[model samples]
Target: MAGNTEPLSPRAKLAVTAGKAAAAVSRAAGRGSGSVIGGRVALKLDPDLLARVAAHLDVVLVSATNGKTTTTRLIAEALRAAGPVVSNALGANMPAGITSALAGGSDARYGVIEVDEKYLAGVARDVDPKAIALLNLSRDQLDRAAETRMLAEKWREGLAGSKALIVANCDDPLIAWAASSSANVVWVAAGQEWKDDAWSCPSCGGVLQRRDDDWGCGDCGFRRPTPQWALSGDYVLDPHGAAWPIRLQLPGRANKSNATMSAAVAAAFGVAPQIGLERMWDVTAVAGRYDVVSFDNRDLRLLLAKNPAGWLETFSLIDPAPAPVVLSVNARGADGTDTSWLWDVDYTRLTGHPLFVVGDRKLDLAVRLEVAGQSFRVCENLDEAVAAAPAGRIEVIANYTAFQDLRRRVGN
Candidate 1:
């Protein structure tokens, strides 16, 4: 079914039908995936469609440089305890994708949306979301997103007059700065695993100093805000200092931090922290992230690594067994046209592991691996590469579009 059908004019109905048809045609022609074409077409026909649909809904928005999709998925899954939730779970996070999700799932009372870092402000202004979850910011899609500080300023300006409760990560300086303008804020010490993107203070351009666990800019007097909600040793600490263990199917400390943020956002909406954390424990995968698929008799644990921060986190998830590692990179629109960011990652961590580089940018990755003193073999065919790997369970790490393609290929 296509969203809530209760309050649509005949003209709007036609527009929706036309948009769905366009999406069908795109899928049939193999020209597009998910709601991208349909959403774009719908928005083209009626420019104000998203704002209209979002008006009646209680929306919780999640945005960050990384983990937007996974965090959004976690929040949506947690909120489903309240009621049916509408969301763009396919990792389509732009304006067009948001429109499609809202229009299609219009009947739902609650919406959980993952927004791109650059587009969060405008989308938040239009949707008037009830709660905004501000996760850590990092350098991603540099060619298109310009600078991280620029986006932070945009967020600060965008939320200046908003009435929504802001759930922000206190660990990230950029996110802390961005959410500072909000009148109502809930700080969460969702651990910042990657600090390379936030070395300088956004306020006074001072060098940010790292203490034992927190960061502070001595020159600017910008220090890490004491969080009302914090994660400590597999447990979430409340303002009262009571701790609750978070058990999730997703691996890594990153997912644990994501769960903590979701728990805080859920608490903002009157949902119990226990309910949120329990529900998040059931989320085994987001999009293709943290999913193990059987491809050509080889088990492929797919991890989506779009940028350096993501790569660093996902690299740790790889099992150090002799199982072959498959890396697929594509310079397609979704994966960012510039492949130079590949060099920024610490691929030296992948030193001893056997690597199979594949995708449009296979040569680029192969060269990077070689430069890192890592030996890798080039294989264009994914199925062939997986079949060739000497393993029972192999790891396949891919960037945006390449991950999507591999997911479908592996029968997801």
Candidate 2:
């Protein structure tokens, strides 16, 4: 039932068939892609559908506060070098979505799954993946998801005594501590740009001392582990000290870190670093992140930033000043109801740019911008915001629901 390539049982076959029918009806009715609903239907019929569908495949679960979707895409692309790969490329990362993806690609040799941070333990337990990539953990969706430390503790407890290889970011102390319980770990210095969530040591609850790129807890012996793979500028250095250039179409150092971790994970599966990087270079965008779509005679570049840690990275990806940056946010169930995390971002970074705010939570964003001493115009919608900007290339940064709204409007 775990790792064999046996044919699906009668119950699982019926469940998968019913799930596919539900997805088709949902899509025809224009009610979204229906991956979530399909998986829901499947699970209702067979509770163990995920395990049964994933039994034959070599699974890799990718989880993080951010970049899990993009990282999942990157890993899937690299793993394709070996054989067919199945992944939830649309960002449906929970149990239902993952089951849909795996069930859809029953013939794929590898399974690269993007898992929600809160559901990682449950998904990992069900899938029994060959590798689990612990990217980085930070405070996100605090109203719904567990607190940063609590999630880390869950990971440590959930993954204890697992046979899967843990490819973790050692730069993040929380991630380091969470992945520490695993017997097999491939430490990667993937660089943590946002450090607010890791001020305290997860081990002894003492203050973590940081100097340059190293971090340690003076009270306890827990510290940054020596990594076998490291991201150095534009290249990734392997364990043998050979530096391979990471020529990726994805922008920013964050993506480079993702690529490095992906390569390391692929290498664990016998895929060479050079081969993996070569395959990864073909990925230009993941689920419309960093996608440039033309609307109203102007090209709108889409960027998704859901939390403070995500906003920090989005700021770095914004176009230079005077490009007219549009900020949008929504506090729907998908996006955490509490918008307090907006204040944690440094919006002053957009001082020189022409700023436009729009979305269901645009007022909340406007107040945060005002408090940060930045000027911005409030618009009724994305069209109003884009029309207000000078016709050319514009940068649009939005949270979960807002980004999807604009993405749909632009026909992307």
Candidate 3:
């Protein structure tokens, strides 16, 4: 039987628990998430803490496969522009982490929390949000649990939802199905080319059909209508930029999605849509997520690619060609030992590039890189790889575990 643990009040609970958790984390290695081990906390039963927490303040829950963290920051910024808001600035989305964030921030009019897929149901129960912005779901963390569809089904079971107001990404079938299956959902979808490769029928495992950017499974006849609040067009940067006139600090279609999603949530919460977009326009870089830190007189731009999807997207912006590059991969409890997703990434595109690779699992990454016909210089660590990088346009792809060593060695 599930143990009945009377959920503590948000403030009281975090106050009592986080002292040891955060201190244990800080002491272990002076790093944040690495120190606070929450494996045991993720399990266990807690009551409907959402109503308890929401009674204290309005909460916004953000979740997605690829871009939730960066998007969460943008939403918080937009909401803060409307009125003072609080958030998990440290990028902790689980129950304990969210508790720590809530406990740590100012008691403000609003709150924004980014949540991981696995923890959503419980965290939703614990922090009953007034609104939720569901971004696209894709294949991620396969080793840890089930497929995206399976997780979608988990949310389908209610997952202790507030059902506040749903801001749904219509282009993503899973998000669309989940949101539309409920009432009071507002669809906020991207345009064509965004949903180019929609996921197939979750049940029959057949190809899903698309009508413009809106999609459905013809075989199963499950269709999610196109979102009404669409960020229809834009000024893409090029010889021909986006048709819109404003400058964007975060480049790429993905960042635009993040910015727009934030704006949409702000609108739902009664912030003037224009005001939210204006705040987003003033946005600059954050620390690790897609931050551009230059070194050696801007000869190289360092991007921290923590996960498989992140690496794939970052590589799209890079030449990975005649120019030399260093791809640092490692395993820490921080990055998780299951690097099996490396197999899912398209390493073939990287094979033709001049490369130097290093990390704890140097041989493993080297073999992965070599199998795609790439040539690589193997190093025992990051410092050696940094020292040996060819003097030209170079990039360093550092996974989460290897990033500390990358920072120490490259110092960018």
Candidate ordering by lDDT (highest first):
2, 1, 3
User: What is candidate 1's TM-score against the reference?
Assistant: 0.95
Q: TM-score of every model?
A: 0.95, 0.99, 0.82
66-139: candidate 2 lDDT, tens digit per residue: 89999999999999999899999999999999999999987888999999988888998898899999999988
Worst 10 residues of 2 by lDDT: 1-10
lDDT (0-100) at residue 91 of candidate 3? 69
In candidate 3, what are the lDDT values of residues 1-412, reduced to their tens digit?
Answer: 0112334456545543544464466657755453124322322222333333334567888888767777787888878876777777656677666654554443466878888788776676666678888887765545664677888877766633456787777677777766765677777654322332255765456788665555677687777764556564552121122223324576666777676677678877787655666677655655454455555444455666666667677677675476777787777776667777676667776756678877777788877776777778987765566567766667777776676666655463
lDDT of 1 by residue, 1-412 (tens): 1223358766666767878888789889977564888888888888877787787788988998888888998899889989889998887789988888887876687889999888888998888889999998887776788588988999999988988899999999999999999899999999888888789999999999998778999997998888999989799998888888999999998888898999999887777888888888778988768888776766789999989999999987899857679999999887789999998999888877778888999999989998999888899769778766775588899998898888778878
lDDT (Cα atoms) of all candidates against the true structure: 0.86, 0.93, 0.64
Cα displacement (Å) at residue 164, model 1: 1.1
Runs in model 1 lying further than 4 Å from the true structure: 1-6, 30-34
Instruction: Give the candidate number with the greatest lDDT.
Output: 2
Q: CA lDDT of 279 in candidate 2? A: 99
Error of 3 at 150 (Å): 0.8
Q: For model 3, name the residue pairs that clash.
A: 25-35, 50-125, 50-128, 234-242, 234-243, 235-242, 235-243, 236-241, 236-242
Task: Score candidate 3 by lDDT.
Answer: 0.64
In candidate 1, what residue range of length 10 has the lowest lDDT sum? 1-10
